[model samples]
Target chain A: MSDMSLATPRAYRRPSTRRIQVLALLTALVAGLILLTLSCGRGCLAPGDVFAALTGAPGADASFVVSELRLPRAVLGLVAGLSFGLGGVAFQVMLRNPLASPDIIGISASAGAAAVFAIVILSVDGWLVSLIAVVAGLGVALLIWTLSARRGAAGARLILIGIGISAMLDSITSYVLLEAPAWDRAEALRWLTGSLNGAQLTQAIPVAGALLIFGGLLAFTARDLEALRLGDDTAQALGVRADGTRLRVTLAAVGLVAIATAATGPIAFVAFLSGPIAARLLPGAKGLLLGAALVGAFLVIAGDFVGQFLLPARLPVGVVTGAVGAPFLLYLIIRANKNGGTL
Target chain B: MMRAERPHRFAGFAILLGLLVLTVGLSLTVGARAVPWDEVWAGLLGQIDSIGAAAVAVRVPRTALAVLAGGALGLAGAVMQGISRNPLADPGILGVNAGAALFVVIGIAWFDISGAQNFLWLGIAGAGLTAVFVYLVGATGQGGATPLKLTLAGTATSVAVSAFIIAVVLPRNDIAGSVQSWQVGGVGGARFDTLLPAVPFAVVGLLLSLASARVLNALALGEELATGLGQSVALGRLMAAAGAVVLCGTATALCGPIGFVGLVVPHLCRMIAGVDYKLVLPLSTLAGASMLGLSDVLGRVVARPNELDVGIVTAFVGAPFFIWTVRNNRMRGL
Candidate 1:
């Protein structure tokens, strides 16, 4: 492990205002990247055409591709990515564990399980199924939180309980699938792995609305989240309502995760990787909420774009994300181990 | 001083023996059919006429498969924990399951291999190749096969292989169906004929692990200390890992990736038997067999006539147990 190098204390030194300027620049860059992702895809819609389509242009093909096909998918990706990024940051900060994410903690699986059950057993509409998924996801999160709370929710204990819950949910899902018809099984599998294909405007609207609501709530608690990084006692000492902040954060994370999962299925690893990527990119930042959201959006959009055009036969966005995220997870593990750090 | 440990050790041994008997009994009696205890006993003892021919065939084959698969998984778990020195380590963590699954998928997708026997070797080869790949990957990292490095490497390999499996097989619905079910893990499709080649591998692996139990105990103290104690740390690790690969590969190939028994059972055994591999290894085997057999029975009973796969049943039970163990500090340290 590398020795910690402490900076010498300087009394009352006023920092330059350049940090704000830099952040503003980075934000612009991220926005530009998002716009670029929207324009560059299989649809071959020019930037002007996409803008014209967005502004109610007269061209039919441009409007159809942009409005009917590309727009919904892009908007869903943006919202889902924001949800995952924000949720991941909140979870990691609240739990004080980098590996803490909706997917890893069984939230996504629970949502997927609920959605599958709804699809296969109850025969409900997709929206009602997604609502059930949100409830199921929250249920799993509450269970893990309650179970790990007794020991003060240490990172390891939380992870262990999460893993256990995940495994159980997975098994139950499998058991359900086994009893389901073959077509249902295939549908469930597709949903479980996650896909952005055929994401209609209806799904996109609710997901986007959820992201806006929850993302705003997360932004409101940004300062508390930053304080949380200094540990619970310190955050509490700093007049932050630690428990309340944790609860709200947990709820927000779950809400975001559930909505995203409902819309796009459980796209794996974006929620897990986004926070770390943001933290790494924006070193010395007090709050990672905005950064994580940007990174999450970047990852999802990039992943979707690659999935669409990278291979001869287009793969699902989830597959591409898994392929990318698996190596990143390994890197995190190795880095943690090398530093004698716990994940 | 060493003599003082004998009574506790003996008690562990007794418990292990009891578990072995119980597992055998449970495996025979519990299945799709409601075979009474007396009939099960008669069937085991060659008094098969007591039961109908159909009942005998179904119960005997299923029971034997359970015991064989369960026992193999248990032993494999012990070997993996021994080699990795991590309580969380399981056969699946080393990519053995994924590797086997990938090959089986490949066999189904490309070769159109259908029967259990035809794909058995493919599973084994896949498992072996994955183990070797994980080992090489872990070794290439800064520290050679340190617990975390090995785990990371194994996990990465598993993901990569699993991705490959999904990519290749998902487009084809038939192969996807076969691969998806197997990926969930099970002991249901196993037959004695399918278990034949794997049995020798399991036996040899188990024996090798048992023989190296004391060495493992020393190695567990830390590799540097083991080296200082005149043990060849590298050789000990190699033997233990090879033993793990064989047992895990064979078990996965035969039964298609039974997950948490290896993860949860060894920790339970360690808590009961107190960390001496001499005791932990054998106790883990018995405990693992019992756990899987009992889970298998529950799988049958839970759905009644429908029947759940044993792997899912084990996960449903094992995950909670693993959580409880971790919470209780029983699975502390590793």
Candidate 2:
């Protein structure tokens, strides 16, 4: 159906059986991690008890832990992870750089800064901050897009500009937190260091809705994403409407991660880490949307598990992901250098 | 064009020095309580007659500390950029401050250590190790540490170190409460006694960087070119990096990881001093000092009665400048 399909990179042309196999495996892994997350706390409910609790088995303890606490948390882990994974890969593919995740590109940080501002300065609480986060996330992403697009969407330039903005926002957020009444310090810190400890259905529901809506939109625009991957001039020649596709992708991607960040408080490096790991897993896999999203889900769930149960003390999911993801980031840089590829 | 610009290089440094002196005056005279010029002058001469005198007494040391830390950071950033040949290079950008912060936190939490003096040693060790680690990681593989790789590696290292710091600090409420100010990097608490010890280290690092200005100049032309032109590129880089680490470590110890001062100051210096390292190095020192002093003053004035950290102020001031640099300039790759 596409005239310029031949010009697309071999990896981007179509997903092979191997890619499907990888995605299947990642889905399976995400399921396993979710089960582990649901059952691994306190009394450590047996799998049967967890299943019973899920199916309305009338036990107060199991139901409270599973339905009220762990269920929303597990659901959020899945939804937020999926959003970051998909959004990250979208940006990476559209920008044609592995490093251009929402985390690195000022989107998540903007949400964080805004949320912090709402909390510390305005003295707001609860899910209202999340709404502000989404607006701020979109606003910051738009600003970054405009600023970086001055000459061209060169990957390095975009990344550099994103970093500068993130740094500025981070400082402002920190100042607000520092100036806030001492009692609010712990709360601000928890928010800054992304956690799912008090995960409620209220937070998880909106994030899940965002994932479903944006995820559907991305699937429909899949052809444009593949076309844009072939390069702007070639995609334009192929009747792809390159800028339109970019705008659509950016809008959907930003919406996906903005909600996820609002829900999870910018889980560090899951968005940055998932795409490359997904690409590694499938090798020749192109259009890594599903694989990356699943991998992201797995990372968050697993990282949460590790943070809560694996360490001597309970740490936040963001802490574990950051600790784990940064090393992988360094490895990618090294490998890219070794391959003589422009990072 | 190069020959005609020789005499003007000194003029750039001269202008920066004058600006720095003016900034010092502003820092003293402008704050929560605005002291008149005569009161500030009288206070400086130890005439303790009025409420303004006490205010000036507290601000003078802070202003001086800002000058010292800012000059050190700016010089450190200049040297780091020159050595790495990466326009984006800054002590904070390259994980040096994060490294220093991590070690300082560890020293405070684990060893029951306190004071700027102990932090200085720990900061130096941590910064030195981080510099080596980032360089090794970035320099490995085919290209031997391109600007992109170094920046990426530096960023990764900083993230990793910061995560570890959080992991350590989060559990201890007492540590968390006290460490917040240090984490953000401020000079508000500077006193005459606290500011005295860091001076020697900053001065030594400054002299070392200034003395090696020629090596930095040659190395700026690329490693192979520098080598061909009778410079030991590796040795020059090592010396420059050492100087940077020391200066940055001292500043971070004294002021807690104020970033972007180093990152932004060098570019301003380069613009004024042309491409000559001999001029850029000294001009950066003055520019850094003046910029930080002014930023500290701005921080105090903006919030009015409540002060902002110099680190926060510098980011607000420097980030736009950094973004503009990226947008407008075709940066030279190291």
Candidate 3:
């Protein structure tokens, strides 16, 4: 055993050096993206004016735009993006599949469908719709989990089932939108496309809370997740209750994603893309929860900035992320295939 | 295996064909305006120029379009699954639907193109180009487009294409209302003249799909086994993929990119007819036509005065079945 261990020569870091370096880089990127999002919008404010507004100093027009509009929008993007990132990484590590993000697993689609149904059919507004969305997201995830568990909880079967459910939920959403009144059509489309347009400070409160709670739980379980990544039998041999850790991690991840969806209407591929990108940046990092969350935040803030200012016509954050993430997804697929790795 | 199964398979085919005829008849008889069987029969015989007969006459084109599109999709789907050797594969998984959608959106938003004929052309062009692009992207890589790689490539193309569609459609509210209905997949607004050009394409696709079954059978045994059998595995895959693209492109044009028929019907057929491509291909075609026709009929019944899109109804029907398929199969890797 000693000779085998010596021959293998597994590399170990203090978790201080590698993780901190990567985290610092992500922190810098997130800060920069937030600043860019705040400064670049319609009636664009100068950096000095934006910073002043953020600090609660008075500057009439700049203050109004920055405080009322850009602040909430940016804050929501930051919080929701972090939730998605953390939730996404949790699922990837737990399930051991890069494609096992919340959006791909029917959670986001079900949430979107419920929200659209509330908006178009029930005529419910604001908080009530968000409540329904969170419940529905959890309900759908539970359903997929139960159904896929019939054969044993293989990730491939779960993903296939999730894709099927997502497609069905999408059809339901499209049907509701089709029957919606003209007045509701634009609002529905905007929400469906996942915009930060018309974001309110009140909306950010629950999202931030969910992020804190679930993100904390996920951080606590990060060590277990790293062990789980070594395979279930090995994890159990290491004195980890593999199933318990997986359940706790998945529940927290689902909750985070549900709340994020309620806030941002399933912003395209933020969750789907963030963990993979974070892994690429911090190669061989354990768990990737923090890095992934930060990457998600960056994607959302930068995507929002680009959609609002870079394009000729204003687009949604979801659209920008989708456009950017899809090519990355393709590249990942190709690279994974070449390396004979399961995506 | 072939000789032993031939008699029983022929019997099953006969039953399916009979069901297809019944579905066609029901499709003619039921709609927004329910017409009596006698009047429909008279309309068929051209025995009367009555008002009810005119309604029956109108139903003919739509029903025919359903049959053509459904058969093409099912056949293409069977071929796709056989070639990819992945049960999850379907015609839409080839990037056809997304490509067609993108082009149609472009046509409406930028070129101001309208009318069914123009939409048909644009859809075909989009689907064909997207399929070719995905194939090239998947095939050029180190392992030459394994099932997983192809599926990923198709999904990525779909995501990017839909994003482009949203980007184009969002700012232009003028096209939103029309494009919304078109994107959902339907046969409600099809005209005989609009469907004319697609008929030849569908027919050719169907013929090629049927002819490629032997190749699919060999291909299904894995590339090494197929090559050992002295088959040009790459050429076979190319032919099968091309046939699928043509069938899928035509179907999308005729009926706004219907989902699940291509994905679901083939699986259903395989369950009844077993896994041989010879039985699966033809059975899928029959079952597909019947399924779409019946769904369209059900769509009319569900919403009463207001109709649900057949696409939505199929999803409602197919989702559970798809889940069941996944749950039952142990899903031996791709």
Candidate 4:
């Protein structure tokens, strides 16, 4: 074991140094993206005015663009990305599989399905819809847990069942879209693909609150998550309440995912991509909670910025993430195969 | 050897007979215009068939299309699972459906191909290309095409293709109706022409699939063992995947990418009859046809004036059944 550890020089080093470096780099990237986002749209708000508008200056169009349009989106991206990144970390840690993400495990799809049902079918308010989404998200997570309980929710089985459930819900969502009128179908489809466009302060409020609550909960459990990296039995032997910790973290992760999915439709691959990016950047990180959250936020903000300004017409943030993330996913698969197919 | 498999084969034969009866009954009696049993019998017998040509034309083709498309999808799914040796595998997973939909979107946007028959070959070509691409990408390294590797490659490629489809098609309002209908997946627009073009393709694909089933069963054990047993594992996998692509592409060209039935029906069939592909494959075809036929009928009946797409109705049924199945037994690894 010592020899094996010695062979992988980077694995045994203190993680905080790498963590700080990654966090610093991500913060810089996000700062640059914010500047770019502010500068691109009509009239090119100067950095001084952008800051002033963000601080709520009165009677300024730059204020309207910064505060109403860009700020909400940027803030939402930060929160949602953090939620997705942290949620992905929690799932990957608990399930002991790198491939595990909220979307892959059916939680985001469930939340999206529930939210859609509430909006289109029940005609509920947005906040109420989010509430129902959280409930449904937890419902799905619980359902998967119960179904896989007898066999102890092996990583592959969890993913397979999640895929099945996700497919079923996606089909149902499609059915709902079909049943809706043409205009409603278009709107629903847009929402399903996830966009940060036209996010209001009200929507941002709940998302922010959920993020703070869930983020804090996840941070508190980070050490236990590191323990979980060892096998369940070994972790238990090391005085970890593996089952209780897993259950709490899983619920908290679902809460974060539901909040994020409610804020932005599943926003393709943010959850799946963030953890690996963090892992790559912070090579010896004990737990990827903070780094993953930062990376996720960066991906979302970057994707949103590109979609808003780079494209001829503003595309959904999800589209940009998907376009960017798909190639990365392919790379991950190839890398995994090259590394002997363990992932 | 074939004689020793007789009872299981006989059970499949019995299920097929039952499915046939159920399908006929579903077609004759259930629909928006609820015809009486006597009238249905007369219509079948060509005695009181003075009904409007619209009703006869609509009902007959719809029912026939459901059976044909459903059988094709189920057969395709079983074949895909067999070849991939992955229970989670489906034609959609391989990007065949996405590829067909993408080209169909392009065809509608670019060429104005209104009729389904004109687009059938395009769909087949698209699906075949995507399958080949996935195979090539998956088989790139020394590990060669493991089931999990294929699934991951296929999934990633499908997402990229689907994103491309949405990006291109969503902004074009003129083709929105066509694209939306295709996406929902239905037999609502099926005609005799659509059914006819797919027949030869489905037949050939089905035959190829059955011929490769025994080899698939051996391959399922593991690639090395199957190779040791004198099976050309790579060749068998390619043939099986080709069969699946042909079956799915042809069917999805006729119907839209109808969901759930392909992914679920095979497992249900396998549960009823043990996992002998010879029996499972044929029974899956029958079960798929019956399930889709019944779902289409239910769609017509449930919504009254407006019809639900058969794809939607299947989820209402299939999702619960799937959840129940997972709850009841231990699902194997992918």
Per-candidate TM-score against the hidden true structure: 0.85, 0.92, 0.89, 0.88
**CAPRI docking class of candidate 2:** medium
Model 1 lDDT per residue over A1-343, tens place: 1232234222212222343443566568657756765576764657887798788867545777677777777777888888888888788777766766777777887887787677778887656876898889889988898888774674556765776687788777777777886455555566566777877878877777778888888889888877877878899899998889988888888888887887787787888888787767554645477778777877787777777787765667777788888888766655554332422
Name the regions of candidate 2 deviating beyond 4 angstroms: A1-17, A123-128, A283-287, A337-343, B1-7, B36-51, B332-334
Give every candidate's TM-score on chain A.
0.86, 0.89, 0.89, 0.90
TM-score winner between 3 and 4, please give it.
3
Instruction: Give the 10-residue window scoring lowest on summed lDDT in candidate 4 chain A.
Output: A334-343
**TM-score, candidate 3, first chain:** 0.89
Better model by lDDT: candidate 2 vs candidate 4: 2
Residue lDDT tens for model 3, B1-334: 2342667778769988998999998888888777777788887776667877877887788888888888888888888788777676666656677798788789889998977767767877887798778876766557776655676677778778877888998898877766767777888887788888777777777887888888888887878999999988888778777778778877876677677787788887766677788888999999889888989888887777778888788878887877776676543343
lDDT of 2 by residue, A282-331 (tens): 75535478889998998899888888888987788888999998998888
Relative to the true structure, candidate 1 has a C-alpha RMSD (angstroms) of 5.1
**Model 3, range A1-343, lDDT digits (tens) per residue?**
7887677534342455767788898999899888877887666678888878888885455887888888899999999899888888888777788877888778888888987888778988777876787788878877888887754564567776787798799889888888775555555666776889889888888888888887888888888889988888999999999989988887788878877787788798898888888887774756478899999999988888889898999988899998988887777666664433532
Q: What DockQ does every candidate get?
A: 0.38, 0.59, 0.50, 0.41
Ordered from best to worst lDDT, the candidate numbers read 2, 3, 4, 1
Better of 2 and 4 by DockQ: 2
Which number leads on lDDT?
2
Colliding pairs, model 3: none
Q: Which of the two, 2 or 4, has more TM-score? A: 2
